[model samples]
Each structure stands twice: as C-alpha cells, then as structure tokens.
Target: MAVNRDKKEPVIEVQDICKTYFMPGGMSQSVLKHVSFDVMPGEFVAIMGHSGSGKSTLMNILGCLDRPTSGVYKLAGKSVSDKTDAELAEIRGREIGFVFQNFNLLMKRTIADNVSLPLIYQGVSEAERHERAVQMLHKVQLNGYEDRLPTQISGGMQQRVAIARALINNPKIIFADEPTGNLDSKTSDEIMDLFTALNKQGITIVLVTHEDDVADYAERMIKIGDGRKVYDGLRAEYQKDEE
Candidate 1:
C-alpha cells in the first residue's frame, strides 16, 4: 500500500548517529556508523536487516532504549542525544509506545493492571487508570479479558494485551520490534492487519522485522547492513529492486 504522506514536520529525525562499544585490551566494536533517517507523521516504516546488521542497535537508539555514542536524535523536533538517562525516560514515557517480540506483560498482574502500568508512572488517578485501561482494552478488542492473568491467554491474545498497554499513553509514535515473531502465520497476518488499521488511523509505526512478509505490511522500507542504511524507499520500489 502506497501511503501519501503530507508535507509536515517529521516525527523522528536522526542525524549522523553512531554507536560503538569498547572491548577488553582497548578494542572497540562499532555497531552503527553515521546512520541517519527521518520518519514522518502517519507513516508506516519497516526497518529490515539480517542478524549482525546493526538494525537492532538502530532500533534501540530510535526507541530511546539506548543512547548513541555520537550524533543527534530529535524526537518531535526536540534533540534527545544530550538528555540525561532520567530525561530520556521521561521523553519515552511521553512520546513513544513500544511492542516487542516477547510480550512483556507482568505475569502476576491482571490484564487491566498491566495495561495501566504506564499511567501509574504518569501519576494518573486510579479511577482514570481503570477507565483508560478499559478504553484501551476495547481498542485492541480485548475488552472482556481485563481481569484475566496474562498466562491464561493465548499468545496472540497476550500480544493484543501488549498492544493495549502500548496504546494506553496515546503515544505519538509506536516502535514494534519483531512483534509477530512468536505467532503462527495466520495470527501474524491478523496482527499485521491490526497494525495496518492503526496506521490508517494516522499512527506513525516503525516496525523492525527480518521477515519479508512482515516488512511487506509497511508502506516504506529501510534496509540496514553492517551498521549503515543500504536502502530507504517506498515498498514498491524495494520490491522492484528485490526482483
């Protein structure tokens, strides 16, 4: 699907970012090298790469989970490269939603409690938390499962709960890292369809996937190799190049 992105300010802007880790004996391993990209509002973008391609490093930086060794990252026009760890956490809570391959729900907590965890950090009242948790559960079609434990649900349903948790804050952008990795094909397709529907509703989605079928769901494709972006273009153009 070709999405028509309007000419608006980018939701994410990464400029000349690099990440490196030092090893024993004064050795250093560079994970990312001068990587740069921008994700516009309401765009669905996939970052694809094989293992050791540094795509994970890039994703970590983009999701605010880790800071780059050098360069600038601007989330919603605010530079985040120099922010303290505490400041970055604040920014993450306010601006980003994250979904992971392993649904990171608290096993002991009820679905409602898990979904409302973010709001707790934001100091939302208990009444508001309950109300918003129910609302988000409805959004993800898990309305009746609120009181159930996460282990009681199927894998797909657990992922849905994770999605509801991610949506509780109404974030400006969503970062999904191999979101369907553990699901069967049919369930994967359903989850991707849900992501498509969300994108259609004007949510900016940045998905990281190694599977071509998974990446196909995105309107834009970005391939990273050896710590650098090898391709950044429309999905159609990427298909042509692959052919």
Candidate 2:
C-alpha cells in the first residue's frame, strides 16, 4: 500500500522540548534543550549523539517512556506531552513499536509466546495470538523457530524474533534504539538491512544510534550535541560535512 505522504500528518512532532532532572541540594541538570523536529509518516530518521549528548533522553521522550519537562510533543497529531501515564501507556501500546539494543525476549518462553505476549494485554484469544505470532515470525523470516527458546538462537536470530514481536501489533511507527549494539558487524548489517526493508514498506522508523555506520542506514540524521540539536538533514549530507 502506498502512503500519501503530503496528505498525511506527521507521525511525530516535537517542538521546543526540554528535560531536566532536579538533584539534591537545589541543583538540576538539563538533558535536552529546546530540541525540535518532525517525522513524517513513512519517513526514516536516525538520532545520533555521543554519550551524555542527551540522545537517550530524547529517545525516551519520543518513545513515550518519559515525558519532557517542558515543550509540546505530538504523536500522530495528538498532543501527548501532558497525557497521563495510563493514557501514554495506551498510546504506546496501540501506535508505537520498540526495538531495543537487547532483544528483551523472555528466556523461558517459546519464541511464539514471546512474540504474542503483547496480545495478552489486549485480551486476545490464545489461538488468535498464536496465529498472528506465526504470521509475524514468517514476516521476519524466522519460520520454523516459533517453538524454540531465545537461548537456542544466535544473537541475530533473537533480534529477528524481537522485530517480529514489534510487528505483531502492526504499529504505525517503530523506535529502534541501538538495535545492533550486541551483534557482530555482519550480523549488524543483516539487522540494519531488515530495518531498511521495513522502512521501504512505509512503516515510519525512528532510530537512535551513535555509530555512523548504523546511522548511514537512515535517510535523515538528527544530531545532538550537549543537550541541543546540532544538525538535522540528509544523512549523506551530514557525512559529507564531516568529511
């Protein structure tokens, strides 16, 4: 299905976002400072920064795992910055998928069970959940592994299982944070290739990474420096500028 990009609203919108943590003795630290960006439907964007540059904090906000101290955040055209925790959880479950650096699969569960875990929260029937899990596993090319455990698979395969689980909900967007951090170079390339294929299918992707090679997989790059957005533009252009 082709997405009409011009007619669709942005999937993510952040304006003048800021986050601060108050410390003991009347001190505070600002992690994000007036950062702003928009991610259109079907767009693939990579957020990059060194440690302590606030990229992780920004990702947490973007993924609805945390809220900014100040500023507006709109997800799929709805203001979410002020939403209650329950509301944010509902939104996260319904509209967003997450792929983390660690696979985050249950070690004791079957691959199919791990993939279908989200559906249990939605009160889906076990049979239907299993069916959908099978379908998602197929989508990730993990056929015939549904009955296996995460420990039985390679790191790359475990990541594939995680991706399949993310897709089981059919979210409008996926937030991947250092998705290839645990893999070897070749495996990392394979995982990035999978992400690229998913992006081509019109699923919006927001990835956070510090590695230039991983960021290269995205078309656009948003670079942060010391709590502020330092650059935002074509990934290739950013590389050229660096060169």
Candidate 3:
C-alpha cells in the first residue's frame, strides 16, 4: 500500500527533547540535547551515530522505554512524555514493537512461545495466541520452525524469530536497534530485505545503526553527533552531503 503522505500526520514527533543524568555530587551529564524530528506513517528512517552520540538515548525515548527528562513526544498524536510509567508501558505494549541487537529471546522457550509472549500480556486466549504466532512465523518465512528453540536456529534465523515476535503484536511502529549487528553480510541483506518489504506494507520503521550500508536501506536518515541531531533529510541528500 502506498502511504498517503499528504493526508496522514506524523506518527512520531519529538520536540526539543533532552535527557540528563544527575550524579550524587550535584554534577549532571546530558545525553540528548534539544533533539527534534518527525516520522510519518509508513516511513522508514535510520538513526545513525557513533558511540556516545546519544542515538541510544533517543531510541529509548522513542521506544517509550525511557521518558525524556525535558521535551514533548507525540506518538500517533498522543502526548507520551509526561505519562506515568504504567501508562508508558501500556503504550509500548500497544503501539510499539522493539527489535534488539541481541535477539532477546528466551532460550528455553519454543519460537512459537516466544512470539506469543506479547499477546499473553494482553490476555489473549491460548488458542488465539498460538494461531497468531503461527501466522507471524509464516510472515517471517519461518513456517515450520515454531517448535524449535532459539539455540536450535542459526543467528540469522534467531533474528527472524525476533522480528516475528515484534510483529506478533500488530504494532503501529517498529524500533530496531542494530538489528543486523549479529548477522553475516548475506544474512544482514536478507533481514534488511524483510524490513523493506514490511515498510512497503505500510509499517513505520525506525532503525538505529552505525553502518552506512544498513542506513542506506532507509528512505530517510537522521544522523546525530555529540548528543544532538546533526542531519535529517532524504537518504539521497545525506549521501550527497557525505560525498
């Protein structure tokens, strides 16, 4: 489905966001400084930065895992920055899907069980959870491996399981942090292809990575440096600027 860019408002909006940590000595460290951006529905954006560049802090805020110390964040037009922890958890469960670099799967659980976890929290029936898990596994092209453990699969396959788990909740947005970090180059390409296909299906995706090749898959790129946004524009423009 082609995204109706003209009619849809931004799915994510961050305004003058900042995150700070205060030490016992009355000293403070700022991680993100006045970071602001907007992500439209069905857009695929990459957040690129080196270590200590505040990309992780921005990701945490975007994912609802952590609230910004100061700023306004609107997800699907609902203000979330000031929400209580319980409310944030609910929002995360309902609207956001997260894919981590580590593939954070339970080693003892079957792939099907892993994917069904999110639904379990939402109190989905056992039969329905299994059914939805199976469907998502199929979507990730892992049709018959639902019964296997994460350790029984290859690194790439485990990542696919993670992606399947992320999608099982039918979230409006997906936040992937270095999703291809653990895979070989060929497998990374395959995973990126899967993400691309999902984006084409109208899912908004925000991926965080330091690799230019990985970021190239995104339609837009936002680069950060020293705890602030350094660039935000079309991928073509970012590439031209790099050149």
Candidate 4:
C-alpha cells in the first residue's frame, strides 16, 4: 500500500539535526550538519552513506541510542530532543525496536530466551515472556526452533531470531542497521522480503545500509555525504536526478 503523506501525521520528525564529538584537548568534530526529514507511518525509508558520512550517527539519534548535539527529534509527534537518558530508555523500550548487523544474541541462551530478553526489562513474567517469544518466532518462521541455542542456527536463522526479538516489544518503529551485512545474497533477499511483508502490514521501517541493492528495498532514500543530507526522495529517482 502507498503511504498517504498528507493525511496522517509523520511517525518520525527530524528538524535541523546535528551531532558533534568533542576531543580531550577542546577539539571537536562535527558529524551531522543540519539534517532534517520526516517519515510517515508505514513508510519504508533507507538511509545511505559511505563510511564517515555520518549515517550511523543519524541512526543512533533516530533510535534514541544517542542525543543530537543540537536540533529537534520527534518520535510519534512528541519532541525527544531534550529527554533525559532514563526517559529516552523508557521511550526506546516502549516505542522503538532495533535490529543490529551483529545479531547481538546471548550465545548460551535458547532462541526463546533471546527473543524474550526485552520483556525482562519491562518486568514481564517468565511465563508470558516465553509465550510472546514463541508467538514472535512463529511470525519470523522460526516456530519449532525456540529451544535451540543461537550457536545451533545458521546465520540467516540467527538474524530471524534477532528480528523476532525486535518485534517482542510491539514497537512503533523499527531501525535495522546493516541487518543483512553478514548474510549471503539469498539470505539477504529473504530478510529483505520479510521486512517488506512487515511494512505492508503497516509497520514503519527505517533501514540503514551502504549497499545499493539493500537500499533498493526501501521506497524512499535519504543519502548523506560529508555530514550533510545530499538527497531525499524516491529511491529510484535519486540516481536519475544525478544522471
């Protein structure tokens, strides 16, 4: 389904966002420079940049993992730019889901345990956590493998477990950073297909990748260069305009 940009309010609003890191000797390096954009509900957006282009920094700000040095960031319409670390953690728990490139799972833990890990922080009971984990595994097509350890699964299946874990919180938005970085081409395609299915179900996805093929999965693209936004529009149109 197409996103209606006019009628519904954006799920993410970033205005003139900027980030800088200060060195010990009063030296500083600016990362993102006055970047801004909005992502409507259910929109599949990809953020792209080469290394040192600040895409990861942008993702950190959007995911509430880090605060911007300056500028406004609103998630679900409320400004989160000034929220405290604790407040941001709460918001992240309640509103954002993250899937990392490394598939950050506990090696010794069972698949179900890993998927249910997020709920432990929310004070959810063990029984319910297992139940929800099973449900999420089923959603990711990993139903019967819940008892297996992460070491027992293929790289692709492990990523599925990561996706299941991300879904356990029923987040308003999902941030997938280089989600297919370790997978083979076929597995990457499968994972992107899953993301596409989820987006069709009205889940907002913000993906960050440097690969053109990976970025192609998203309907819209936001490209950054030298800490500045160089492009924002339909993914297909970006190169066409450059050409």
Candidate 5:
C-alpha cells in the first residue's frame, strides 16, 4: 500500500529509494528501483522475496546500514538521506534492534551478558545493565536461563534470548532478518508467537524472509520479485494463492 507520508505522523518514510551496486567483471546491478514504503510507529510488516529479489538491500537501507544510491529516506520525521556515517550509526543503535537467523549470540557469554550488550554500547552503567538484561530475559520467558551460554540452550531458546537482547534497549523498531529460518516448524511457530506478543506490546517489527511459512506470522506481507514489489497487502491474499 502507498502510505500517505504527508499525514500527521509517520515513523519511517521512504520516497523512491533506488539502490545499485557495481558488480565485478565490469557490470553494475540494480537491486532496488524506485522502492517506496512507510512504516508507522507500531506496525508489524513483513518483506518476502526470492534469493535475488533485493529485499536484503531494502532492509539495509531501512536500517541505515547503507545509504541509497539515489532517493530519500526519512526516519522519525527527519530526513536521513544526508547523515554522516557516525550519525547514521548513532541512529541505528538508538532506533533499531536487529535479530538474525543465526541467533548471533556470543558463545562465551552468558545469556545475561548477551542481553546486556546493547545497553553496554549505549553507556548504561554495568550494574543497571545487568538488571535490565535480566528483566528483558524474563520478558522473553527465559526467566532462569541467565547463566546459560548460547550453546547450552536449544535453538528456539537461543532465539528467545536474541529477542530479549533486541528488546533490552527498548528500540523504536525491531528488524528481524529471517529470524526463524533455521528452526523446525514447531520451533518456528514458537518464535513467531513471541513476535506476536511483542507486537501486541507496541514494538514495530519488520521481518525479511523468502519463506512464506515464516512471513505468515505477520499481519501484512509485501512480496517482491526481480527487484520490484509485486504485491503488498494482507496475508489472506497470499494464503489464497497457496490454496
């Protein structure tokens, strides 16, 4: 859907974003072209695409990891197109929390330490960070696993820890890149349920994955192919096609 960015409020607005890269062997590839989308303050959206569908490129732009080759991006009503690298990094750290498919936990660290990582970067006091991390772990239903290393837990439990770590700092939006990609169906369902619960508590979520099975967890889904959006709307339509 085309979001009315000129409306009174929009947490994230992108106008005609285009991302291209120069591949080796004297070839340039366009991954995203004139892509536009908006994410409201508390919306949970999903982006679905095939391997080369440019979803990852869009995720990078939305998360401010890379600037668009040409186009405008506004975050929290402020234009972010011209931010310096340091400035962009600051915004990313403050406004966004990222969860990856691999769980991205530190094996040597306990669950408490992993959840404390983001706050530590923000300069929170060590004692307070530990306390907040413990709280977040509890929020994700990992009440008594604070001392467990990443390897000591099941894959699903580790993902919950990752989710807790993402929420420890209470970011405005959480970007999950194929969060359940590595888990079995049962485990994937559990992880998606956690996402649903988080959304209920008002954290905007944007997930990227090629698997429709995973994307079904979100209320809205956008499908892409050949670097352009093919569909964007309720999941019911995609479900109909599946049937």
Candidate 6:
C-alpha cells in the first residue's frame, strides 16, 4: 500500500518486515507479520502493547539484534539487511544506546566502570573512558556516586546511572525497553522526568511500555495488537479522544 512508502527518509525505516521462528516439528511461528513503521529524527516515541502482540519482536528487529524473514530495514537511511554482523555491531556501538528495565550493571565494577563499558568496546583509552563516564555521571546528577557499587545506591539512582551509561556513547538514538518496568511509582516518575530532560536536549528516544501514563510522557505513542499497529498518533490527541 501507499502507507508503506514515505517521502521523507526516516531515521528508521522498516517495510513489510516479517519474522518467523521454526518450531519443533518444522512448523514455523510468525512473530511479526508484515510489520512496518518509520521513526523520524529527534522523535520521542513510545510503543505499547500486550505480551503477545509482537512488540518485543519488533523491538529486537529494530535494534538489529535479529533479522526479519522478508523485508527491508534501514537505520540512518542505510540498509541494515546488507550489513554483516561486524558492520551491524559497529553501527549499534556508534549510533544506538540501550536502556533496559533491569539496570544491567556489573556488580563487580564501580559505577564509573559500568558506564564505561561501551567506550571500552569501542577501543577508547582507559583514561578517556573514565573521564567521559565521569562526565556522563555528572550529567545524570550522580557526580560523586561513581565510586559506589549499584547495590549501594537507591533503585532510582541505579536507573539514573544506567541512563548515564546509555548516554555516555553520545548515540544518535536511545532505545529503552520497559525502562521503568522494575521501578516503583515515584521512581518511575523520576525516570520519566530524566527522559524529558534528555529529550529537551535533542536526544532521540524510543521507549516501550505497556502503561498508558508512562506512554503519555512520550511525544508520540504507537499501540500494537495481534502483530499489527492498531494506533499511532500524537499522545495529546490520543488523550483528548480518551477524554
């Protein structure tokens, strides 16, 4: 259909993406069926859906962790399907920052060390990595907490450190999969506020959350059901309709 094509070159472009997994007896299960979407530059968007709606599968494909069975995926206007694993890793390392609900920090490392992981992978010098990580911690308002272990900090602070780690790479876009899934109510608000602040500074963010209130924080919301995009629009318009 005409909806599959757009005049503008989206920062992320996916068309007719279908993903299937092989089952025990050679049967295949389709996780994403003809999923297609576009993400523009500097956009703050949230994806919401139920457990079996294929949102996670779409996220994996969008993040380049998995490939689609029959479709095209473009990142930064370049075709992802043609890239090798090393090339994909290079693209992800240099352009995408990821935040997860678990905070995924290394308990054995200090906060500074935890934040420096990506830079280390990029072959940055130790001194430069620590310096950049420290600056990022300061940006997230965790300046002096660098020496502390994640266990020593509050849940909110741990998430803040994770946010800092995600930003340390100065990525083109940040992908947050259920960023506040494990946080308490108050902590969730704080995380949302952090995202707001980051967005104000021009960081593109793609968030996935099932909670409507959480999704409202994003500029745009997309709802998926039965492997199809059921709703896509500005959050304010969606809220107005609900009222």
The CA lDDT of each predicted structure is: 0.90, 0.93, 0.92, 0.93, 0.87, 0.87
Which numbered prediction scores highest in lDDT against the true structure? 4
Screening candidate 4 with a backbone cut-off below 3 angstroms (N, C-alpha, C), the clashing residue pairs are none
Candidate 3 lDDT trough over 10 residues, lowest sum? 234-243
In model 2, the worst 10-residue window by lDDT is: 234-243
**Higher-TM-score candidate among 3 and 5?**
3
The digit string of per-residue lDDT tens for model 3 on 185-223 reads: 899999999999999998999999988889899999999
lDDT of candidate 3 vs native? 0.92
- Candidate 5 TM-score, true structure as reference: 0.92
- Model 5: lDDT equals 0.87
Candidate 5 lDDT, tens digit per residue, 106-216? 999999999999887678998998899889989989999998899999999999999999887688899998898899999999999999898998889999987777787
Best by TM-score: 4
- On a 0 to 100 scale, what is the lDDT of residue 10 in model 1? 89
Q: Residue 230 in candidate 4 has what lDDT? A: 92
lDDT of 4 by residue, 36-133 (tens): 99999999999988888998899999999999999999999999988899999999999988999999999999999999999999899999999999
* Residue 3, candidate 2: C-alpha displacement in angstroms: 15
Clashes of each: 0, 0, 0, 0, 0, 0
Runs of candidate 6 with Cα error greater than 4 angstroms are 1-8, 239-243
Query: Which ten residues in a row are the worst by lDDT in model 4?
Result: 234-243
Misplaced by over 4 Å in model 1 are 1-7, 239-243
Model 1: lDDT of residue 14: 92
